[model samples]
Target: MEADEKIEKISSQTLISNSPSKRIRIRPLTKASLVLRGTLVVLVLLTAYTFYTIDVKDVNFVQGMIGTAKNVKVMFLEPHLSHFSFSHALYQVMITLGLAFLTTVFGAIIAVFLSLFAAQNLSSKRVSVVIKGFAAFIRAVPTVLWVLIFAVAAGLGSVAAVIGMTFHSISYLIKAYSESFEELDKGVIEALQASGASWWQIVFQAVIPSSISYMISWTFMRFEINFAVAVAMGAAAGAGGIGFDMFMASSFYYDIREIGAVTYFILVIAILLEVLATQIKKRLKVNI
Candidate 1:
Protein backbone atom coordinates (compact mmCIF):
# COMPACT_ATOMS: atom_id res chain seq x y z
CA MET A 1 0.00 0.00 0.00
CA GLU A 2 2.89 2.37 0.88
CA ALA A 3 4.70 1.60 -2.41
CA ASP A 4 1.52 2.19 -4.48
CA GLU A 5 0.84 5.50 -2.66
CA LYS A 6 4.41 6.61 -3.22
CA ILE A 7 4.21 5.78 -6.95
CA GLU A 8 0.90 7.71 -7.26
CA LYS A 9 2.35 10.74 -5.45
CA ILE A 10 5.51 10.71 -7.69
CA SER A 11 3.40 10.37 -10.88
CA SER A 12 1.16 13.32 -9.78
CA GLN A 13 4.23 15.46 -8.93
CA THR A 14 5.89 14.60 -12.34
CA LEU A 15 2.68 15.51 -14.20
CA ILE A 16 2.37 18.79 -12.30
CA SER A 17 6.03 19.66 -13.00
CA ASN A 18 5.73 18.80 -16.69
CA SER A 19 2.46 20.72 -17.19
CA PRO A 20 4.27 24.06 -17.52
CA SER A 21 6.93 22.73 -19.98
CA LYS A 22 6.74 23.26 -23.75
CA ARG A 23 5.27 20.36 -25.75
CA ILE A 24 7.71 18.11 -27.61
CA ARG A 25 8.15 19.49 -31.12
CA ILE A 26 8.57 17.56 -34.39
CA ARG A 27 11.64 18.33 -36.39
CA PRO A 28 11.30 20.28 -39.62
CA LEU A 29 12.59 18.77 -42.85
CA THR A 30 16.27 19.28 -43.53
CA LYS A 31 17.53 21.25 -46.57
CA ALA A 32 18.59 18.01 -48.27
CA SER A 33 15.13 16.52 -47.84
CA LEU A 34 13.44 19.66 -49.17
CA VAL A 35 15.77 19.63 -52.16
CA LEU A 36 15.00 15.96 -52.82
CA ARG A 37 11.26 16.64 -52.61
CA GLY A 38 11.58 19.59 -54.97
CA THR A 39 13.62 17.54 -57.44
CA LEU A 40 11.04 14.75 -57.38
CA VAL A 41 8.24 17.26 -57.96
CA VAL A 42 10.13 18.74 -60.92
CA LEU A 43 10.78 15.27 -62.38
CA VAL A 44 7.11 14.34 -62.01
CA LEU A 45 6.02 17.53 -63.73
CA LEU A 46 8.51 17.05 -66.56
CA THR A 47 7.38 13.45 -67.07
CA ALA A 48 3.72 14.52 -67.14
CA TYR A 49 4.43 17.35 -69.58
CA THR A 50 6.46 15.10 -71.89
CA PHE A 51 3.76 12.43 -71.95
CA TYR A 52 1.04 15.00 -72.52
CA THR A 53 2.92 16.53 -75.50
CA ILE A 54 4.13 13.28 -77.06
CA ASP A 55 2.87 12.37 -80.56
CA VAL A 56 2.02 8.82 -81.64
CA LYS A 57 2.34 8.04 -85.36
CA ASP A 58 -0.28 5.80 -86.98
CA VAL A 59 -0.28 3.17 -84.26
CA ASN A 60 -3.31 1.54 -82.62
CA PHE A 61 -2.60 0.83 -78.91
CA VAL A 62 -4.73 -2.31 -78.82
CA GLN A 63 -3.10 -3.70 -81.97
CA GLY A 64 0.37 -2.85 -80.67
CA MET A 65 -0.32 -4.55 -77.35
CA ILE A 66 -1.74 -7.64 -79.15
CA GLY A 67 1.36 -7.80 -81.37
CA THR A 68 3.60 -7.47 -78.31
CA ALA A 69 1.74 -10.35 -76.66
CA LYS A 70 2.20 -12.50 -79.74
CA ASN A 71 5.92 -11.66 -79.94
CA VAL A 72 6.37 -12.50 -76.23
CA LYS A 73 4.52 -15.75 -76.69
CA VAL A 74 6.73 -16.73 -79.64
CA MET A 75 9.90 -15.63 -77.87
CA PHE A 76 9.19 -17.53 -74.66
CA LEU A 77 6.93 -20.42 -75.62
CA GLU A 78 8.31 -21.46 -79.01
CA PRO A 79 11.99 -20.81 -78.42
CA HIS A 80 14.39 -22.62 -80.76
CA LEU A 81 17.68 -21.74 -82.43
CA SER A 82 17.48 -21.35 -86.24
CA HIS A 83 20.91 -20.25 -87.56
CA PHE A 84 23.32 -21.67 -85.00
CA SER A 85 23.72 -25.15 -83.59
CA PHE A 86 23.46 -25.74 -79.84
CA SER A 87 27.21 -26.40 -79.74
CA HIS A 88 27.99 -23.02 -81.36
CA ALA A 89 25.74 -21.25 -78.89
CA LEU A 90 27.46 -23.07 -76.04
CA TYR A 91 30.89 -22.05 -77.37
CA GLN A 92 29.83 -18.40 -77.62
CA VAL A 93 28.57 -18.62 -74.05
CA MET A 94 31.97 -19.94 -73.00
CA ILE A 95 33.62 -16.92 -74.66
CA THR A 96 31.41 -14.57 -72.66
CA LEU A 97 32.19 -16.56 -69.49
CA GLY A 98 35.91 -16.38 -70.29
CA LEU A 99 35.76 -12.58 -70.65
CA ALA A 100 33.92 -12.30 -67.31
CA PHE A 101 36.34 -14.64 -65.56
CA LEU A 102 39.47 -12.96 -66.95
CA THR A 103 38.26 -9.48 -66.04
CA THR A 104 37.24 -10.60 -62.52
CA VAL A 105 40.56 -12.30 -61.84
CA PHE A 106 42.59 -9.33 -63.10
CA GLY A 107 40.42 -6.83 -61.26
CA ALA A 108 40.57 -8.78 -57.98
CA ILE A 109 44.33 -8.96 -58.16
CA ILE A 110 44.76 -5.22 -58.79
CA ALA A 111 42.02 -4.11 -56.37
CA VAL A 112 43.53 -6.09 -53.50
CA PHE A 113 46.68 -3.94 -53.69
CA LEU A 114 44.85 -0.65 -54.44
CA SER A 115 42.41 -1.25 -51.59
CA LEU A 116 45.34 -1.26 -49.13
CA PHE A 117 45.63 2.45 -49.85
CA ALA A 118 41.89 3.04 -49.94
CA ALA A 119 41.15 1.54 -46.48
CA GLN A 120 41.33 4.30 -43.84
CA ASN A 121 42.64 1.97 -41.16
CA LEU A 122 45.43 0.70 -43.41
CA SER A 123 46.40 3.98 -45.10
CA SER A 124 46.81 7.71 -44.43
CA LYS A 125 43.80 10.00 -44.88
CA ARG A 126 45.18 11.74 -47.99
CA VAL A 127 46.08 8.46 -49.71
CA SER A 128 42.71 6.93 -48.89
CA VAL A 129 40.86 10.00 -50.11
CA VAL A 130 42.82 10.13 -53.38
CA ILE A 131 42.39 6.43 -54.09
CA LYS A 132 38.68 6.51 -53.22
CA GLY A 133 38.16 9.61 -55.33
CA PHE A 134 39.82 7.99 -58.35
CA ALA A 135 37.74 4.84 -57.85
CA ALA A 136 34.58 6.95 -57.63
CA PHE A 137 35.41 8.64 -60.92
CA ILE A 138 35.99 5.29 -62.61
CA ARG A 139 32.73 3.91 -61.23
CA ALA A 140 30.82 7.03 -62.32
CA VAL A 141 31.56 6.24 -65.98
CA PRO A 142 29.38 3.54 -67.52
CA THR A 143 31.13 0.27 -68.41
CA VAL A 144 30.04 0.62 -72.05
CA LEU A 145 31.49 4.12 -72.22
CA TRP A 146 34.77 2.83 -70.86
CA VAL A 147 34.78 0.06 -73.44
CA LEU A 148 34.22 2.59 -76.20
CA ILE A 149 36.94 4.84 -74.86
CA PHE A 150 39.45 1.99 -74.72
CA ALA A 151 38.25 0.67 -78.06
CA VAL A 152 39.91 3.69 -79.69
CA ALA A 153 43.30 2.39 -78.61
CA ALA A 154 42.77 -1.39 -78.49
CA GLY A 155 40.48 -1.48 -81.52
CA LEU A 156 37.00 -3.13 -81.51
CA GLY A 157 37.58 -6.61 -80.08
CA SER A 158 37.94 -8.74 -76.93
CA VAL A 159 41.03 -6.73 -75.94
CA ALA A 160 39.11 -3.49 -75.46
CA ALA A 161 36.25 -5.27 -73.71
CA VAL A 162 38.57 -7.01 -71.24
CA ILE A 163 40.53 -3.82 -70.47
CA GLY A 164 37.40 -1.71 -69.97
CA MET A 165 35.58 -4.35 -67.92
CA THR A 166 38.65 -4.95 -65.78
CA PHE A 167 39.06 -1.21 -65.21
CA HIS A 168 35.50 -0.85 -63.91
CA SER A 169 35.80 -4.08 -61.95
CA ILE A 170 38.97 -2.87 -60.23
CA SER A 171 37.26 0.36 -59.14
CA TYR A 172 34.23 -1.56 -57.88
CA LEU A 173 36.24 -4.21 -56.05
CA ILE A 174 38.54 -1.59 -54.51
CA LYS A 175 35.59 0.11 -52.84
CA ALA A 176 34.14 -3.21 -51.71
CA TYR A 177 37.44 -4.56 -50.42
CA SER A 178 38.49 -1.33 -48.70
CA GLU A 179 35.15 -1.16 -46.88
CA SER A 180 35.61 -4.80 -45.85
CA PHE A 181 39.13 -4.10 -44.57
CA GLU A 182 37.82 -1.11 -42.57
CA GLU A 183 35.33 -3.43 -40.85
CA LEU A 184 38.25 -5.23 -39.15
CA ASP A 185 38.36 -4.72 -35.39
CA LYS A 186 40.74 -1.85 -34.54
CA GLY A 187 41.88 -3.66 -31.40
CA VAL A 188 43.30 -6.54 -33.44
CA ILE A 189 45.29 -4.18 -35.68
CA GLU A 190 46.56 -2.29 -32.65
CA ALA A 191 47.53 -5.53 -30.94
CA LEU A 192 49.50 -6.60 -33.99
CA GLN A 193 51.32 -3.27 -33.98
CA ALA A 194 52.21 -3.63 -30.28
CA SER A 195 53.61 -7.14 -30.86
CA GLY A 196 56.40 -5.63 -33.05
CA ALA A 197 54.80 -7.12 -36.14
CA SER A 198 55.83 -5.71 -39.48
CA TRP A 199 53.08 -4.06 -41.60
CA TRP A 200 53.30 -6.80 -44.23
CA GLN A 201 53.18 -9.50 -41.54
CA ILE A 202 50.15 -7.95 -39.92
CA VAL A 203 48.35 -7.62 -43.27
CA PHE A 204 49.12 -11.20 -44.35
CA GLN A 205 48.41 -12.78 -40.96
CA ALA A 206 45.45 -10.73 -39.76
CA VAL A 207 43.90 -8.63 -42.51
CA ILE A 208 43.78 -11.14 -45.36
CA PRO A 209 42.60 -14.05 -43.21
CA SER A 210 39.89 -11.99 -41.50
CA SER A 211 38.58 -10.51 -44.74
CA ILE A 212 39.13 -13.40 -47.22
CA SER A 213 35.49 -14.46 -47.12
CA TYR A 214 34.23 -10.98 -47.89
CA MET A 215 36.77 -10.72 -50.69
CA ILE A 216 35.55 -13.95 -52.24
CA SER A 217 31.90 -12.86 -52.00
CA TRP A 218 32.63 -9.51 -53.64
CA THR A 219 34.75 -11.09 -56.37
CA PHE A 220 32.00 -13.54 -57.29
CA MET A 221 29.41 -10.78 -57.33
CA ARG A 222 31.63 -8.71 -59.62
CA PHE A 223 32.17 -11.72 -61.88
CA GLU A 224 28.40 -11.97 -62.27
CA ILE A 225 28.20 -8.30 -63.19
CA ASN A 226 31.11 -8.63 -65.60
CA PHE A 227 29.35 -11.53 -67.27
CA ALA A 228 26.30 -9.34 -67.98
CA VAL A 229 28.51 -6.49 -69.15
CA ALA A 230 30.48 -8.82 -71.41
CA VAL A 231 27.23 -9.85 -73.05
CA ALA A 232 26.38 -6.26 -73.87
CA MET A 233 29.96 -5.62 -74.98
CA GLY A 234 29.76 -8.55 -77.39
CA ALA A 235 27.17 -6.66 -79.43
CA ALA A 236 28.13 -3.08 -78.69
CA ALA A 237 31.88 -3.44 -79.21
CA GLY A 238 31.99 -6.40 -81.63
CA ALA A 239 33.56 -8.57 -78.96
CA GLY A 240 31.82 -11.58 -80.54
CA GLY A 241 29.87 -13.79 -78.12
CA ILE A 242 26.34 -15.05 -77.55
CA GLY A 243 25.29 -11.39 -77.25
CA PHE A 244 26.31 -10.78 -80.88
CA ASP A 245 24.23 -13.78 -81.86
CA MET A 246 21.36 -12.36 -79.82
CA PHE A 247 21.69 -9.00 -81.53
CA MET A 248 21.87 -10.54 -84.98
CA ALA A 249 18.82 -12.67 -84.27
CA SER A 250 16.81 -9.73 -82.99
CA SER A 251 17.83 -7.11 -85.51
CA PHE A 252 18.91 -8.82 -88.71
CA TYR A 253 17.01 -12.09 -88.71
CA TYR A 254 14.11 -10.88 -86.57
CA ASP A 255 14.05 -14.38 -85.11
CA ILE A 256 12.33 -14.21 -81.78
CA ARG A 257 12.70 -17.96 -81.27
CA GLU A 258 16.50 -17.77 -81.62
CA ILE A 259 16.63 -14.81 -79.26
CA GLY A 260 14.56 -16.74 -76.74
CA ALA A 261 16.88 -19.74 -77.00
CA VAL A 262 19.92 -17.52 -76.31
CA THR A 263 18.06 -15.92 -73.40
CA TYR A 264 17.44 -19.36 -71.88
CA PHE A 265 21.09 -20.28 -72.29
CA ILE A 266 22.20 -17.12 -70.50
CA LEU A 267 19.62 -17.67 -67.74
CA VAL A 268 20.78 -21.25 -67.17
CA ILE A 269 24.43 -20.17 -66.96
CA ALA A 270 23.53 -17.43 -64.45
CA ILE A 271 21.72 -19.94 -62.24
CA LEU A 272 24.66 -22.32 -62.42
CA LEU A 273 27.13 -19.58 -61.52
CA GLU A 274 25.02 -18.66 -58.46
CA VAL A 275 24.91 -22.29 -57.38
CA LEU A 276 28.67 -22.60 -57.85
CA ALA A 277 29.31 -19.49 -55.78
CA THR A 278 27.08 -20.83 -52.99
CA GLN A 279 28.90 -24.15 -52.99
CA ILE A 280 32.33 -22.49 -52.89
CA LYS A 281 31.24 -20.30 -49.98
CA LYS A 282 29.98 -23.35 -48.13
CA ARG A 283 33.20 -25.25 -48.82
CA LEU A 284 35.24 -22.33 -47.49
CA LYS A 285 32.98 -22.01 -44.42
CA VAL A 286 32.16 -18.42 -45.34
CA ASN A 287 29.01 -17.24 -43.52
CA ILE A 288 28.45 -14.26 -45.79
Candidate 2:
Protein backbone atom coordinates (compact mmCIF):
# COMPACT_ATOMS: atom_id res chain seq x y z
CA MET A 1 0.00 0.00 0.00
CA GLU A 2 1.12 3.58 -0.69
CA ALA A 3 2.29 5.76 2.26
CA ASP A 4 -0.62 8.21 1.70
CA GLU A 5 -3.15 5.32 2.09
CA LYS A 6 -1.27 4.19 5.25
CA ILE A 7 -1.99 7.56 7.02
CA GLU A 8 -5.77 7.01 6.51
CA LYS A 9 -5.65 3.82 8.62
CA ILE A 10 -3.99 5.59 11.52
CA SER A 11 -6.31 8.59 11.23
CA SER A 12 -9.42 6.39 11.13
CA GLN A 13 -8.10 4.33 14.02
CA THR A 14 -7.64 7.51 16.11
CA LEU A 15 -11.29 8.47 15.49
CA ILE A 16 -12.52 5.03 16.61
CA SER A 17 -12.83 3.86 20.26
CA ASN A 18 -9.69 2.60 22.07
CA SER A 19 -9.22 -1.16 22.78
CA PRO A 20 -6.41 -3.38 24.16
CA SER A 21 -5.30 -4.36 20.58
CA LYS A 22 -6.00 -0.98 18.94
CA ARG A 23 -4.77 1.37 21.70
CA ILE A 24 -2.88 4.47 20.37
CA ARG A 25 0.64 4.74 21.72
CA ILE A 26 1.27 8.35 22.69
CA ARG A 27 4.86 9.37 23.48
CA PRO A 28 5.00 11.80 26.39
CA LEU A 29 7.17 14.91 25.95
CA THR A 30 10.49 14.48 27.72
CA LYS A 31 11.11 16.85 30.66
CA ALA A 32 14.47 17.93 29.23
CA SER A 33 12.90 18.97 25.91
CA LEU A 34 10.01 20.67 27.68
CA VAL A 35 12.40 22.66 29.88
CA LEU A 36 14.54 23.56 26.89
CA ARG A 37 11.51 24.93 25.04
CA GLY A 38 10.33 26.84 28.13
CA THR A 39 13.78 28.42 28.59
CA LEU A 40 13.89 29.50 24.93
CA VAL A 41 10.46 31.11 25.24
CA VAL A 42 11.53 32.97 28.36
CA LEU A 43 14.72 34.22 26.66
CA VAL A 44 12.74 35.45 23.63
CA LEU A 45 10.32 37.34 25.88
CA LEU A 46 13.23 39.00 27.75
CA THR A 47 14.89 39.96 24.45
CA ALA A 48 11.68 41.54 23.14
CA TYR A 49 11.18 43.50 26.36
CA THR A 50 14.79 44.79 26.21
CA PHE A 51 14.44 45.78 22.56
CA TYR A 52 11.25 47.74 23.24
CA THR A 53 12.90 49.55 26.17
CA ILE A 54 15.91 50.59 24.07
CA ASP A 55 14.05 51.34 20.83
CA VAL A 56 11.77 53.91 22.46
CA LYS A 57 14.73 56.27 22.99
CA ASP A 58 15.89 55.94 19.36
CA VAL A 59 12.53 56.24 17.59
CA ASN A 60 13.81 58.51 14.79
CA PHE A 61 15.49 55.65 12.88
CA VAL A 62 14.94 57.27 9.47
CA GLN A 63 16.40 60.64 10.51
CA GLY A 64 19.43 58.91 12.12
CA MET A 65 20.00 56.85 8.96
CA ILE A 66 19.85 59.98 6.78
CA GLY A 67 22.40 61.75 8.99
CA THR A 68 24.72 58.72 8.78
CA ALA A 69 24.31 58.68 4.99
CA LYS A 70 25.48 62.33 4.79
CA ASN A 71 28.58 61.48 6.90
CA VAL A 72 29.61 58.79 4.35
CA LYS A 73 31.43 61.41 2.27
CA VAL A 74 33.73 62.26 5.19
CA MET A 75 33.89 58.61 6.30
CA PHE A 76 34.37 56.81 2.98
CA LEU A 77 34.78 59.21 0.02
CA GLU A 78 37.89 60.88 1.45
CA PRO A 79 39.57 59.26 4.45
CA HIS A 80 41.93 61.08 6.83
CA LEU A 81 45.50 59.71 6.71
CA SER A 82 45.87 57.66 9.88
CA HIS A 83 48.36 59.28 12.28
CA PHE A 84 48.54 61.90 9.51
CA SER A 85 50.82 59.66 7.38
CA PHE A 86 50.64 56.70 4.95
CA SER A 87 53.91 55.07 6.15
CA HIS A 88 52.60 54.73 9.70
CA ALA A 89 49.48 52.88 8.58
CA LEU A 90 51.60 50.53 6.40
CA TYR A 91 54.00 49.80 9.29
CA GLN A 92 51.17 49.12 11.73
CA VAL A 93 49.39 46.78 9.32
CA MET A 94 52.64 44.80 8.83
CA ILE A 95 53.02 44.43 12.58
CA THR A 96 49.50 43.04 12.92
CA LEU A 97 50.15 40.48 10.15
CA GLY A 98 53.49 39.50 11.72
CA LEU A 99 51.89 39.09 15.15
CA ALA A 100 49.22 36.76 13.76
CA PHE A 101 51.77 34.67 11.77
CA LEU A 102 54.05 34.22 14.77
CA THR A 103 51.20 33.18 17.04
CA THR A 104 49.77 30.58 14.64
CA VAL A 105 53.17 29.04 13.75
CA PHE A 106 54.26 28.81 17.40
CA GLY A 107 50.86 27.44 18.46
CA ALA A 108 50.91 24.73 15.76
CA ILE A 109 54.45 23.67 16.74
CA ILE A 110 53.55 23.31 20.43
CA ALA A 111 50.30 21.52 19.62
CA VAL A 112 52.09 18.92 17.43
CA PHE A 113 54.04 17.57 20.41
CA LEU A 114 51.14 17.79 22.85
CA SER A 115 48.59 16.16 20.54
CA LEU A 116 50.39 12.78 20.68
CA PHE A 117 49.58 12.49 24.37
CA ALA A 118 46.13 13.96 23.86
CA ALA A 119 45.02 11.40 21.24
CA GLN A 120 43.26 8.47 22.88
CA ASN A 121 44.24 6.20 19.96
CA LEU A 122 47.94 6.93 20.54
CA SER A 123 47.98 7.48 24.32
CA SER A 124 46.19 6.08 27.39
CA LYS A 125 42.56 7.10 27.86
CA ARG A 126 43.42 8.63 31.26
CA VAL A 127 46.20 10.77 29.74
CA SER A 128 44.11 11.89 26.78
CA VAL A 129 41.15 12.78 28.98
CA VAL A 130 43.29 14.82 31.36
CA ILE A 131 45.06 16.67 28.55
CA LYS A 132 41.77 17.39 26.83
CA GLY A 133 40.32 18.78 30.06
CA PHE A 134 43.23 21.22 30.38
CA ALA A 135 42.83 22.33 26.78
CA ALA A 136 39.07 22.68 27.29
CA PHE A 137 39.68 25.09 30.16
CA ILE A 138 41.88 27.26 27.96
CA ARG A 139 39.44 27.05 25.07
CA ALA A 140 36.57 28.20 27.27
CA VAL A 141 38.36 31.53 27.83
CA PRO A 142 38.16 34.16 25.10
CA THR A 143 41.36 34.99 23.14
CA VAL A 144 41.14 38.68 24.12
CA LEU A 145 40.91 37.81 27.82
CA TRP A 146 44.01 35.60 27.51
CA VAL A 147 45.89 38.52 25.95
CA LEU A 148 44.93 40.77 28.84
CA ILE A 149 46.00 38.20 31.45
CA PHE A 150 49.41 37.73 29.84
CA ALA A 151 49.73 41.48 29.43
CA VAL A 152 49.97 41.79 33.22
CA ALA A 153 53.10 39.65 33.27
CA ALA A 154 54.66 40.40 29.85
CA GLY A 155 53.58 44.08 29.86
CA LEU A 156 51.44 45.61 27.13
CA GLY A 157 52.91 45.24 23.60
CA SER A 158 53.31 42.69 20.78
CA VAL A 159 55.15 40.34 23.17
CA ALA A 160 52.10 39.98 25.39
CA ALA A 161 49.84 39.77 22.39
CA VAL A 162 51.85 36.93 20.81
CA ILE A 163 52.11 34.98 24.06
CA GLY A 164 48.39 35.26 24.87
CA MET A 165 47.26 34.49 21.35
CA THR A 166 49.67 31.51 21.19
CA PHE A 167 48.35 30.16 24.49
CA HIS A 168 44.79 29.92 23.16
CA SER A 169 46.03 28.86 19.73
CA ILE A 170 47.87 25.86 21.23
CA SER A 171 44.70 24.51 22.83
CA TYR A 172 42.79 25.14 19.60
CA LEU A 173 45.40 23.23 17.58
CA ILE A 174 45.61 20.44 20.16
CA LYS A 175 41.87 19.75 19.87
CA ALA A 176 42.01 19.88 16.04
CA TYR A 177 45.23 17.82 15.74
CA SER A 178 44.27 15.11 18.25
CA GLU A 179 40.86 14.67 16.58
CA SER A 180 42.60 14.26 13.20
CA PHE A 181 45.08 11.77 14.66
CA GLU A 182 42.25 9.80 16.22
CA GLU A 183 40.76 9.39 12.71
CA LEU A 184 43.94 7.85 11.26
CA ASP A 185 43.54 4.39 9.70
CA LYS A 186 43.07 2.02 12.62
CA GLY A 187 44.16 -1.02 10.59
CA VAL A 188 47.43 0.67 9.64
CA ILE A 189 48.17 1.41 13.29
CA GLU A 190 47.37 -2.17 14.24
CA ALA A 191 49.54 -3.58 11.48
CA LEU A 192 52.42 -1.33 12.50
CA GLN A 193 52.02 -2.50 16.08
CA ALA A 194 52.05 -6.13 14.96
CA SER A 195 55.33 -5.49 13.11
CA GLY A 196 56.82 -4.15 16.37
CA ALA A 197 57.14 -0.59 15.05
CA SER A 198 58.22 1.93 17.70
CA TRP A 199 55.83 4.74 18.62
CA TRP A 200 58.01 7.41 16.98
CA GLN A 201 58.40 5.42 13.75
CA ILE A 202 54.66 4.68 13.55
CA VAL A 203 53.83 8.35 14.15
CA PHE A 204 56.24 9.66 11.50
CA GLN A 205 55.60 6.97 8.86
CA ALA A 206 51.96 6.10 9.43
CA VAL A 207 49.98 8.56 11.54
CA ILE A 208 51.67 11.73 10.30
CA PRO A 209 51.45 10.74 6.63
CA SER A 210 47.79 9.82 6.91
CA SER A 211 46.69 12.97 8.75
CA ILE A 212 49.08 15.72 7.55
CA SER A 213 46.50 17.19 5.19
CA TYR A 214 43.88 17.60 7.92
CA MET A 215 46.50 19.08 10.25
CA ILE A 216 47.52 21.66 7.62
CA SER A 217 43.88 22.52 6.93
CA TRP A 218 43.18 23.03 10.64
CA THR A 219 46.34 25.16 10.96
CA PHE A 220 45.20 27.46 8.16
CA MET A 221 41.79 27.85 9.80
CA ARG A 222 43.42 28.70 13.12
CA PHE A 223 45.73 31.16 11.37
CA GLU A 224 42.71 33.08 10.11
CA ILE A 225 41.27 33.22 13.64
CA ASN A 226 44.60 34.38 15.06
CA PHE A 227 44.84 37.13 12.45
CA ALA A 228 41.47 38.50 13.58
CA VAL A 229 42.58 38.35 17.21
CA ALA A 230 45.85 40.09 16.31
CA VAL A 231 43.92 42.93 14.71
CA ALA A 232 41.77 43.33 17.84
CA MET A 233 44.83 43.11 20.08
CA GLY A 234 46.46 45.83 17.98
CA ALA A 235 43.89 48.25 19.35
CA ALA A 236 42.93 46.72 22.72
CA ALA A 237 46.40 45.79 23.97
CA GLY A 238 48.32 48.77 22.57
CA ALA A 239 50.00 46.50 20.05
CA GLY A 240 50.17 49.11 17.28
CA GLY A 241 48.56 48.18 13.91
CA ILE A 242 45.98 49.32 11.41
CA GLY A 243 43.44 48.23 14.03
CA PHE A 244 44.84 50.97 16.30
CA ASP A 245 44.32 53.47 13.52
CA MET A 246 40.75 52.29 13.15
CA PHE A 247 40.27 52.52 16.92
CA MET A 248 41.65 56.07 16.94
CA ALA A 249 39.28 57.16 14.19
CA SER A 250 36.31 55.64 16.02
CA SER A 251 37.26 57.23 19.36
CA PHE A 252 37.83 60.65 17.77
CA TYR A 253 34.61 61.13 15.81
CA TYR A 254 36.18 64.08 13.94
CA ASP A 255 38.48 61.60 12.13
CA ILE A 256 35.62 59.20 11.22
CA ARG A 257 36.64 59.60 7.57
CA GLU A 258 39.95 57.83 8.23
CA ILE A 259 38.05 54.85 9.64
CA GLY A 260 36.54 54.27 6.20
CA ALA A 261 40.01 53.94 4.64
CA VAL A 262 41.29 51.70 7.45
CA THR A 263 38.19 49.53 7.18
CA TYR A 264 38.65 49.16 3.40
CA PHE A 265 42.29 48.10 3.83
CA ILE A 266 41.37 45.46 6.41
CA LEU A 267 38.54 44.18 4.23
CA VAL A 268 40.88 43.73 1.22
CA ILE A 269 43.60 41.99 3.24
CA ALA A 270 41.06 39.59 4.81
CA ILE A 271 39.61 38.70 1.41
CA LEU A 272 43.06 38.06 -0.07
CA LEU A 273 44.02 35.76 2.81
CA GLU A 274 40.78 33.77 2.48
CA VAL A 275 41.39 33.21 -1.26
CA LEU A 276 45.06 32.32 -0.64
CA ALA A 277 44.08 29.76 2.00
CA THR A 278 41.51 28.14 -0.29
CA GLN A 279 44.09 27.85 -3.12
CA ILE A 280 46.68 26.40 -0.76
CA LYS A 281 44.22 23.82 0.56
CA LYS A 282 43.27 22.79 -2.97
CA ARG A 283 46.94 22.40 -3.99
CA LEU A 284 47.69 20.45 -0.81
CA LYS A 285 44.82 18.03 -1.58
CA VAL A 286 46.00 17.57 -5.19
CA ASN A 287 49.57 16.89 -4.07
CA ILE A 288 48.40 14.43 -1.45
Q: Clash pairs of candidate 1? A: none
Model 2 stretches with alpha carbons more than 4 Å out? 1-33, 55-59, 69-74, 80-82
| RMSD (Å) of each candidate, 1 decimal | 6.4, 6.3
Q: What C-alpha lDDT, on a 0 to 100 scale, does residue 190 get in candidate 2?
A: 94
Candidate 1 per-residue lDDT over residues 1-288, each given as its tens digit: 999999999999999888888676597779998999999999999999998987878888799999999999999999998999999999999999999999999999999999998999999999999999999999999999999999999999989999999999999999999999999999999999999999888889999899999899899999999999999998999898999999999989999999999999999999999999999888778353
| RMSD to native, candidate 1 | 6.4
| 1-288: candidate 2 lDDT, tens digit per residue | 699888998888866745656655496679997999999999999999988877557558899888889888778888667455777777777888888899999999999999989998999999999999999999999999999999999999878998999999999999999999999878999999999999999999999899999999999999889878888998899887877777877886557778888877777778988999999999999998
Model 2: lowest-lDDT 10 consecutive positions: 16-25
Candidate number with greatest lDDT: 1
Model 1, stretches more than 4 Å misplaced?
1-41, 286-288
Model 1 — which ten-residue stretch has the worst lDDT? 279-288
Q: Distance from true position, residue 209, model 2, in Å?
A: 1.2
TM-score on alpha carbons, each prediction = 0.86, 0.85
